[model samples]
Every structure is written in C-alpha cells, then in structure tokens.
Target: MEYDIVMEPPTPREFVHLRSAAGMRERSLDAARAGIGDECAAVTIRADGDLVGMGRIVGDGATVFQIVDIAVAPDHQGRGLGSRIMNELVSWLEANVPPSAFINLIASEPAFYEEFDFETCAPELVGMDLTLPTESESSHAQ
Candidate 1:
C-alpha cells in the first residue's frame, strides 16, 4: 500500500479540515481559524494533494511552546508520517526556540513520543486532566 506522500507546510484552512477528519476534538471553526494565526506553524503530509497527516507547534512563540494537533488519517497511520511531522516540528524548535524556553505536549501515545525524546512529566511534578469540564459536560449531555 505504497502511496506518494508529500510533506508541505499547512495553511490554517487545511489544518482545520484535516484535524477534524482525523477525529480530533471538535473545535469551533472560528477557533480553528484563529488558532493557526501567527502563533503556530504546521506541516502536513499529502498524497496527490489530499491531506494524510499533520502536526503543529502552538504557543507564545517565545517562552512557552507546546506541540499540538499531531494527527494522521487512519489510512495513513502505520507509515512514518507522524515521525516526519515531529522531526520537522522539532527541527523548527531547535533552530528557533531559545535554550531557556519550555517545550511540551500532551501526547496521544506516550511510547511514540518517547522515541522523539519527549518524556512524561513526573507524577509528583505535574498534574493531569484526562478530560476537560466542557468535554465531560458534552459527554454527559449526550
């Protein structure tokens, strides 16, 4: 199942659509629209111009930077698109972020991120929320 995967930088519009299709938590289109504005840059993988994978770096672009929205379409999963996206993001961080800056992500898969040098925060040092109140409310209402 080899396909021609091309990695290209993502525009905000394309990022929203691909993120939605990848089963990401639903966000308002306006929020998604505003999200990629200036603060973040994304890389997307496409096959014949159809999006297959994407990842983005989002934050203040200085002191606090978090990697967010890394996703690959189901059909494209098992290939190296996620790694490719991470590599690009990390490279960007290396070239751009200062040594004193903090980079973080709430990974979908801990093991996968570990390969890229991301480690889990120590339980004693950090608190985590598995689901936000809004997400919980939405689930309960449904």
Candidate 2:
C-alpha cells in the first residue's frame, strides 16, 4: 500500500493510537496533547487517510535535539515506511538545524538507526533514562 508522508505532527488521538498499535509503550492522551506540537520537526505518514507512521525531533531546537516517537503501524511495517519517515526527519534536520546542534535518540534497535549514521554513545558516554511514577503510583506509595 502506498502512503502519503507529510511534514507535520499527528493529532493527539492519532499519536496515542499509532504508538500503541506499533507495539510501543502506552502514553496518556493528556501527555500526547501536551507534547505532540512541541517537536522541532515531525513527519506523519497516512494510508487511506489513516495515520500509519510518524517521527519527531524534540528539544531546545537551537543547541539540543532528540529524535523520538518513530513508529509505524504493525500491518504497515517492512514496507520502508520507517525509512521514509527517517529520511524526512534527517532531511529536515539537515536543512533546518544548525551544524553545532547535539542531536540524539534512544533506540532499542541501534542497528536500524545506524543506517542513518546514528552511533551508539557508548564507552565515551552511556545512555540513561528515568521514568517518573504516575499519579496513582505516587499516591499509593505515599
């Protein structure tokens, strides 16, 4: 199936649904609504008018940037949609971001991103993250 890739962020509902459908972690609708438009660059791919793939670049935009939320629906995987999304993202970064900006991404499959020249920041630097507890979890703990 052919897809229409656009240089824009997905709607919050579409963003939440597509991420889950792509086997990624679930994110709250509130979080989606709050965060979707904060990206410096975003790509959305749709088929038959349904959003099927997306990628985003988020950060301070000037000196720091992180690629995030790259996803493609399960049924649409392996058709090079991810590559298309990445191509749009890399192209946007190349055209818009400054040469001195620090761009990064956290990937489970480093090999996939390596195709785009993303190297693992190991040895010299380690990737680390911390997920904050939800409201319910915090209340239960208290």
Candidate 3:
C-alpha cells in the first residue's frame, strides 16, 4: 500500500513538535523563532495530514550552511522518511548554494549523512562548542 507523504515548508510551531518528537535538542520559543527565517531552506513531511518528519538548512545563504534537525517521528521511522528529507534538503542546497558555500552537520549516525555526501572533518578539523551554564546552575556555582 502507498502512504500519503506530503512534503511542505514547515511553520514555526511544527518545527517545535517535529524536533521534540524526533529526540533533538529543545529550543526556547524565541530561540526557535530566531533560527528559522527568510534565508532558511526547510521541508516537512506530512503522512495523511500529520506532521511526521522534517529537515532544514540553516546559515547564511551563500557562505555557510548546516543541515540540521533532520527527524522523523518514532512511528514513522524506518520508512525512509529521513532519507527523503535529506534528499529534499540536499536538492535545495544543490540548486541554490554556490561552490564556495560550506555545508555542515553533526549526525548521530554519520553513515546516514554519508549517503548525501556529508563527511566528518575530523583529524583535519574538529567540531567544538561552548555551552553556557543556565542561570540556576550559574547561581549554584557562585
């Protein structure tokens, strides 16, 4: 039987649900608001009208971009929805981004991303970040 998979650009609220359901990091409403904007290339899959998967390209349209928040709901996992999402995001990048643009992503399973030409910059380079302590935690530290 064929499934009804409708892919569309996701609204802000849908991103929140998709991210949480897919086990990605949570963002505050304001932070999420800040993340998605005119420059973003995003796609969401609706299975019979329910939002089941999503992916997005975030960063400067030309200089930098990151493939992020690729997620399929638990019930929808293993049906290749993640692959479909990546395909759409990569298509967007291919059509819109120039050669100088750098596309990056941090994947739990790097193999999945490798299918779309993603490579780890390890050894030659490393991914790093600085997480700020929450207010309560900082107060305790003080």
Candidate 4:
C-alpha cells in the first residue's frame, strides 16, 4: 500500500489536473499556460507517473513573491504530502529569494501555513481579488 513519490517540475497539463484533483478552484487554461512553466519555484509530487500534489511560487524574483496553488490529491491527503510540498517550496524560497522580498500565500487553512511562519494579516490588511468575468459568463449571469 506504499507508493514512491518523486518531486519535480510540473507540466502545464499536470498542473491543471493536480489542482482539480486536489479540490482547488479551476483556473483558466490561459493562466496555467502563462504561469506554471515559468514559476520562480515549482514542485510536483508524482506517484507512478501521475501528479498527486503540487505547489509553486510566482512573482518578480527580487522584490515580491507569492506561494500559490498548494494542493494534494484527496486520495492522498492525510499523509502530510501537502507539508512535503510546502517544504520543497519554502526551502527553494529560503535559498533563493532576496531578504527584502515579500513572501505571501493565501492559505485555505491559515493554521497550515502558519506552521511555516506565515502570519495572518488581519485587521490592518486583508487579501483581496478581482476576477473579471469573461464576456459570455458575465452576460449569462445578468
């Protein structure tokens, strides 16, 4: 009942699949194409040639960076695979990101991220997002 999982860079398609299987929000194909391949840091956990977990860091290498899309397949959850993914990601950031760089991540479970020293930015500041609806989707909603 044991499988060997190896960590490596993820392909765009694998990134999309991992995100979905992990129950994360579905991202646009265009965004995945543009981001995953060139992420400042990326890690893919592959079990038997299938992607089972992933995480990435993106943004300008010098001044700002965000850790995004940390996911582990539902079938593989509860095994600390997500933590392993974070370890790979944080290790890379620690070794490479500039001391002045602002590292951030929007954690579904703030407690999970807090284990890695990510503090909750509450009261004083909050994370916000503006998702511009697509032409068809917006029209349909009205």
Which model scores highest in lDDT? 2
Total clashing residue pairs per candidate?
Answer: 0, 0, 0, 0
- Residue runs of model 3 more than 4 Å from their true location after superposition: 1-9
Question: Could you estimate the TM-score for every candidate?
Answer: 0.79, 0.97, 0.86, 0.89
Clashing pairs in 4: none
Clashing pairs in 3: none
What tens-digit string does per-residue lDDT give for candidate 4 at 11-67? 778778878887787887677788766778778777777788888888988999999
Global lDDT scores for all candidate models? 0.77, 0.93, 0.79, 0.82
Instruction: Kindly give the stretch of ten consecutive residues in candidate 4 with the minimal lDDT sum.
Output: 1-10
Residue range with the least summed lDDT across 10 consecutive positions in model 3: 1-10
lDDT of 3 at 68: 78
lDDT for 56 (candidate 2):
94
Which residue pairs overlap in candidate 2's backbone?
Answer: none
- Candidate number of the best TM-score: 2
Q: Order the numbered candidates by lDDT, best leading.
A: 2, 4, 3, 1
Angstrom error of the Cα, residue 42, model 3: value is 0.2
Candidate with the larger TM-score of 3 and 4: 4
Looking at model 3, residue 96 earns an lDDT score of 89
lDDT of candidate 1 vs native?
A: 0.77
Model 2 misplaced regions, further than 4 Å: none
